[model samples]
Target: MTRETLTWLNTMTLIGHTDRRGTAWHYKASEQGGEPNHYPGAIPLKDVRARLFNWEGVHRRVAVELPASTFTEATHYGLDNKPMRWEVIGNRSALDRSDRDTGAVFGVVGPDYKIHQYSDWLLENVAGLLHDGLSVSSAGLLKGGAVAWVEVSVPENLMTDEGVEFRPNLLATTTMDGSSATVYKRTITDVVCDNTRAVALKESGAEFKVRHSKNSELRLEQARDALQIVDTAADEFRRQVAELCAIAVTEDDWQLFLDRTVPWGTKTGKPDNDYMRLLKEERRENLTYIYRNDPRCAPWHGTAHGVVQAVNTYDHHVRLPQKKEDQEPDRVSSWRTDRNLQRTVDGLFDELDRETYLDLEAVLEQAA
Candidate 1:
C-alpha cells in the first residue's frame, strides 16, 4: 500500500474482528481483535486501547476507511502522532513449566490505580485490629454472676469486668439481650470478634500515626475511638464525591482539569447556556447528532455535554475550557460516573453503628 497521511480521524477498530457476547468481558487486546497476522502477534495492550479510546475521543470520523484487506499499516495521521501497530518478534522458555512470553513486545500497561487502592485498604483494616483489644463482659451479658468470659478480676476500685462502680453504676460496653439471659452464656471468642470488628470499623484510618500506648487498656481505648473517627471521615469522603459528581457527570469541572493540557482552539470556549439547555431537550439523540462539530455545536461547551457528543460520534474529541469562567476548567471530553461509591460507604456506616455508647470504656453495642 502507498504511504498516505490520515490527518483526519481514521483509526476506529472494526468490530468485525473483536468478540463480545453475553456477559464475558475481554481486556486482552491481542486476543480480542485484528488479524492473527503476527498478533497471535505482539502489540502493547495500552497501544491498542489508546487507539480505541483516542478513536473514541475523536468521535470516529474518517477520511478514507480501510478496504476489506487486513494488511493496512497503522501509522499516525498527525505528523506527530505515534505509529499504532505491533508485531511479536521473538520468544523463549524460562523453565520446563514456564514459557518465556518475552519478545520485542511493543505496548504500555494499563494504569495501576486499582492495585494501589487495594493495598491501601489492607493497611487501614489491620491497623484497627492491632489497636483495639476485645472487652467481652458488658451489661445484659452472663447473668447469675457466672459468665463464660475470660474472667480477669481487677480491684473493686479499679475497672471491673462490668465497669467502675459509681453513684450510678456505669454500663458495660459489651452486652447481651437474648431470650434467657439467666441461661445463655456468651463465648469469649464470639464477644472478642464483635469488639475487634467494631474497633476495626472505627479506627481503620488512625493506626497509621497514633502509637500504641504502653498501657494495654489505653491502647485498646485509643483504637476503638479511632474507629469512630474513621467512620465520620469515610462519610465525609462520600458526600464530597457526590457533590463533585454534579460537576463530574456534567463535566462541569472538566474545563478546570482540561485547561492544564488542551490547546486554545477556534471555538469561543465559553459555556453555552444554549447548549446546557439542549440537555433538557425532549429528544436528545437527534440533538446530540447535530452537536458534534456541526454548525449548531458552538453551544455545547460543558465537559459532560461534549462527552455526549463524543459518545454519539465514537470519535476522539477535546474541548478547551472557557477562560472566561472564574475558575479555569480542565479538559475531559470522556468521563465516567463513580459507580457503587456510596454503597461502600453505607456498608462502613453499618459496621460503625454496631457499637456506639459508653461512659468511658469501649462501646460494645448501641446504648439504650
Candidate 2:
C-alpha cells in the first residue's frame, strides 16, 4: 500500500470519538469492517493518555558507518591528521516505540529540534480545560504517531436561531513529522452532519501555533489566550451562519454553481471520456440529492448556508473513496478531508453574497 493508504489505516486503529450527546455518527472505521470506537460522553483524560498517546517521541542522532574500503586516506583524515571512525550527522530522527508503529521513524530533523512528549503537553495545556467544564471529545494519532491531536469541547451542544446545532471544539494538535507546528485552533462540528469546520473568521483569528524549537514551551504559555476562542467561537460562527442564511439562492443559481464547482472536462478543455463523464455526472447528481433531500442540508435549503452545508456533507459522507476493491471500502483519511474542507470553505466564502450567487468562479477559472 502507498504511504497515504498506510497512514489512513494506522489512524483508524488509533482514534476514538465521544458520543457528542448521542449525535456523532459511527466513524468511517466502523463502516470499513472495524468495530466502533466510541466513548459514551466526554473521554476522560486518563483514558486519552492510556488508549491513545501513551508513548513518547525519542530523538536519536542520525549516522551511518562507512566501509573503510570506500574512503581514501586523504578524504577520511580529520583536521588533526588522524583517521575518523565515527561521526554524528547534523540531523536526528524522532522514533516512537509504541505498538502502533514500533520502531517507526516519525521524522528527520535538525540538531535543534525538540521532542515534545504528547502526554506532557496534554497535562500542561489540555488538563486545565477540563476544569472549565470542557471535556476531551476526540483523541488520536495519525501517520503512525507522526501527528497527534486531542479535541476539547463543552459537554452540551449549542444551536443557532436558524436551527443549526453544533459543538465548538479547541483542537490541540502537534506533529513529529514536521507537517505542522504545535497548534491550538478552534473548530465547529455540525451535530447534524458530523462535519468539522475550521473556525477561521476574518475578524478574529482562531489558532495559535508554536514551532518545534527550544522556546516552544514558553510560546505555549502565551498560547493560553487562544484557548479563549472556545468561549467566543459559537457567537462568531452564529453570525456567519446568519449572514449566509439571509442570502437567497434560486434553483437556477444552484445549477450554475454546481456547473462551475464541479465542471465536466479535463483541465486541457477536452471533453471527458465515457467513464470519466459518467463519474462526473454521478457526482453532480449526488450533490443535488444532498441539497434537496439530505436532512443535514434540506433544513437550510434555498439559502447560501444550505449550499455550503450540502457540499460539506457530501465531502464528509457521500463522496466516493479514493480506493476501493470488491465489496469493502477503503478508509478515507480525515487529514486529507479536513484540508480539502478548509480550502472549500475559504473558496465558497471568499466572495459569497446575494449579488455574487456563490462566486467560486475565480477558483474554478484558475483550476481550468
Candidate 2: tens digits of C-alpha lDDT, residues 100-141: 444457767777677677786754567854555577777666
Among the numbered candidates, top TM-score falls to: 2
Give the TM-score (vs. native) of candidate 1. Answer: 0.17
Q: lDDT per residue, candidate 1, 1-368, as tens digits?
A: 01111111112211111111111111223443453211221223333323321211001111332322233676333344444443332231111101113322212122211111111121222233432222111111021111111111111111112211111011111111111111111111011111111212122322223211222122445434444443333333333223322332223233222222222332577554665545333223443454344432323433232323232222212222233331233212111000111111112222322221111012111111
**Model 1 residue 16 lDDT score:** 15
lDDT of each: 0.23, 0.64
Identify the runs in model 1 with alpha carbons over 4 angstroms from their true place: 1-218, 248-256, 261-368
TM-score of 2: 0.77
Name the top lDDT candidate. 2
Q: How many residue pairs clash in each candidate?
A: 30, 0
